[model samples]
Target: MLEGTEAVLAAQLRRLLPHLDERQRRLVMGAAAGVLGRGGIRVVARAAGVVESTVSRGAGELDRGPELSGRVRAVGAGRKRLVEADPGLIPALLALVEPDQRGDPESPLRWTVKSTRNWPPS
Candidate 1:
């Protein structure tokens, strides 16, 4: 299930449908499933009978949220980031680690160089 912020986000997305073209509106509804914890773009697009790029674009726009309220949506391939999609994590992550010892046991997950994929299994 989606958290409160996500539910609000999904609601906001549904509210934006009236402003979109038919194709874009279909894309927005597809992307909203992922926002509501239904699934990712692949599944959403498949369910909506639309192209993955369409859903991807809609998800990208939703990510921008109300910040782009009056702006026109841009057309392009979106960039994939190395980090998870949650926007509230940066300060939490930075607060949890020091500059030099980030790879140390300070991380709650305790991931380490010793746990590197190439390390021989015991």
Candidate 2:
């Protein structure tokens, strides 16, 4: 039988969480639920997803000892800092869309307005 979302989410959390403190357990589980509730970090962010800085802070707390989550560092592999260093990425990617481009005429890739936003349909 298919598992419910909460059950599936709990199972996923169990895999990611080995040994966790009480607070860490709550926070981490909450984070996982947050992921399921919305979409991802960016979506959560757009929804004022409780501020990534808070999540980062919680992650810091969770990383204080080996009892919660893992002791592995550099989760982003240093790419986060690198991306932050370059500020032109957002504008550059946005410039790829042309206003005149209408909906796709077959399977062709053409941008269109979706949800009042210009985004390529998936």
C-alpha TM-scores of all predictions: 0.33, 0.24
Please write out the lDDT profile of model 1 over residues 35-68, one tens digit for every residue: 5564566655554555778777767666666444
Candidate 2 structure quality by residue, lDDT tens digits, 1-122: 23365455545655655676545554674465354454433332333324655444555554564454454343455346544888887666556554555775675576744344644545
Q: What is the C-alpha RMSD of each candidate to the true structure, in Å?
A: 16.4, 16.7
Q: For candidate 1, what is the TM-score?
A: 0.33
Give the 10-residue window scoring lowest on summed lDDT in candidate 1. 68-77
Q: Judged by lDDT, which candidate is best? A: 1
